[model samples]
Target: MPFIPHTEEEVQEMLVAIGAASIDELFDEIPENLKLTQLDAIPTALSEMEITQLMGKRSLQDGEPSCFIGAGAYDHHIPAAVWQLTTRGEFYTAYTPYQAEASQGTLQLLYEFQSMMVALTGMDASNASLYDGASALAEAVLMSVRANRKSKSKRVLMPRTVHPAYRRVVHNIVRNQQIELVEVAFDPKSGQTNLAVLEQYAGEDFAALVIPQPNFFGVLEDVDALTNWAHANGALAVGVVNPLALALLTPPGLWGEAGADICCGEGQPLGAPLASGGPYFGFLCCKIAQVRQMPGRIIGRTVDLDGKVGYSLTLQAREQHIRRSKATSNICTNQGLMVTAATIHMALLGSEGLERAAAASFQNTRHLVEVLTAIPGVEVMFEQPAFHERVVRLPAPAKGILRSLAAHNVLGGFDLSADYPELGNALLVCATEKRTEDEIAAYAQKLERVIQLQGGVTCGLVPKE
Candidate 1:
């Protein structure tokens, strides 16, 4: 979105028509001290042509770098036909199918999305979508508390291995509602949540237990054990999974004997880009019994008067039309556009294709770890098996090493110092299927140079196993 300048006369005319005396009146709610008097850093007005030229020159300053950071959003390859088909007028301009008859195409697309999610997660039902992964987790936490009729306590066992931002969002959304998020610490050595810690809460009445497949540190957890443990204590198993990883890893529904009650995760890797942290949608799925508790729109396939197959909004017990008390959640709008794109992405890449991509990602990450650890003083931080991302300890401060890598046109990895301070200078690195052997080698070469520049101490190479 480009900035369009307005004429003073046009601005004044618009302001007068809107019942505002001046621009300042519109922002009366903003604190007097907080409002900036002027933006001195902003350059003077330039012609469109001049601005375009200047932007081109500035854009070149930040050369294209190999991406290795996949904390939440990934850098997976989207097929060419994905966006091409998604942007078609019929799909692009379609809004929520409030009147199912008017927006059948949109409803149908959403239904397909839900069906695909069900197949992927092995859940009985799926909602259209919520805002993003973080908000989706908040909704899942809330849903667990409401659906757990057996448990009296609103406590949910949230492991420290869950995404930090997601934990914060869950706390903010659920705390006021008296929902307690009990934080469970991870194993310092493996960067995984051990069952021994979970044993402490064996008899406690908790509404749910969140189990991340490859947790925040990217270490794969024992999902079957965790899910079974949650069920043994009469708690709902809430799985926060990576959709891409679900291609190869066991899904939430197959985790234990009964499987996870609810599953949710970010749908960004499906088709959405890392367009400045995104417009990514979050998907929520649950068993048939818990379908009534799931939030967001749920589209159902049905027969018309003519006995024609059709799509319709189903089990909607939330927002504007429903009574406040009866509503499951306050999720207002649907992430229909993102969901549509993801559907197209999945359609283009069938299950076999997704599995291949997942396998490639896992192999590449393992190879990357092997390559990176070969360097002196650089070692794998965790001893557990991981998916595409893993935490690796750098000999020097991660931030400085990352900055140096950036100068060499490489995005090394995400620095986890501030978030996980105990793991000093630990860098959370990822190598998706998109990363080639050459790219991985280049990253390692530049990283070694950076370490040498920092006078990194030479040490015996630590085995990645």
Candidate 2:
């Protein structure tokens, strides 16, 4: 069927009503030079089966490469049951779940999700979900401003160690709001937040301090010291975290326990695929006092007339639909499906399973790091303990090294020099539970070979595969 809804006469009448002589007039705002002047080089139509086969073939090209890439998003294990249950028509097609009476299941799922996030983050309260990690951080910054009773200066202190894209999101969301963003630099030797430097910038004018747990370089920051510092300055401490790492590391709520006011993170590692970068969930959790300032919807458990349990959207004061300028945020959609999937995955794994997965990823990554650093020209960038990722300084240019590794069908880690110039020729490698020991060993061998090919030789050892 044609996608256009109007009949020819209806289209003509609509065009005439709009004072346009033809359909092309509707697109007059588009520059004439930019308009397509010729038909595409390929046929416009294909049989459904042909299209399917074509798509399948295109997808196969992705497998021709091995993926070792991780900056924020990771390739992790997803159980078959997660897909099977999520794909059902009842869950897959559902959205909003606005009609609480009709959306009990969805609301309950969101409630459970919120509950899980609260437990994972160690925060007093959690929202249903946000757009993704970056937006969540942005929202948390805004929430900090709202929580500061004495501050009108909308200044936020964010460390350079936080994900680069996340910092960009903060700029995008806060720029028009007249918020001032101050970037705190990391210690050159440690690759972690310089608390002394952060303290120098801390003041009454600042609304919040944003730090990433197991920051972009994969070094875990001292949350206790940082959170205390932020609080001492009367600023909220916001911890941007990786959800999977929470399985083994201290939860951000513990940061709250240490005095952080807000905690938020990317939930992508929790059963959400990279999907070429996103459509993942951003989770926000905070002290109960900041619930009114939270940016997204909240689902609460209630009771029915018969005294049975029920769930409904509650505490929606922050949403724009309810209050225009008074709204805490303009975000309306809750990222329902993605949040649901994460919630289901967490529930399926429970605490013990999640801990095991985290442990395996940690052990595997440590082993890989040991092997890679054994290469003469390669050195571990941060000797600090990491959760599932690490950074290595390469004797050769990182881009050249990555290209060489790619030739051998191994996707290399993110090159830090692309963003951190000081960390010259460094690559941030990540391994998850999904990576096998053989894969790790193969990666080390390939990296060694790539380094040697670049005319860089490792010290004190003969090459062995």
- Cα lDDT tens digits, model 1, 271-329, are 99887678999999999999888898899999999999999998765554674767888
TM-score of 1: 0.87
In candidate 2, stretches whose alpha carbon ends up further than 4 angstroms from where it belongs are 2-45, 202-204, 256-258, 458-465
What is the clash tally of candidate 1?
0
| Model 2 lDDT tens row, 23-130 | 898899999999997687868878789999999999887775656778998888887777688778888898788898899888888898989988888888898888
- Give each model's whole-structure lDDT: 0.90, 0.85
- Model 2, 277: alpha-carbon shift in Å? 1.3
TM-score of each: 0.87, 0.89
Cα RMSDs, all models = 5.1, 4.8
| Colliding pairs, model 2 | 121-253, 122-253, 132-282, 376-458, 376-459, 377-458
Q: Pick by lDDT: which candidate is best?
A: 1
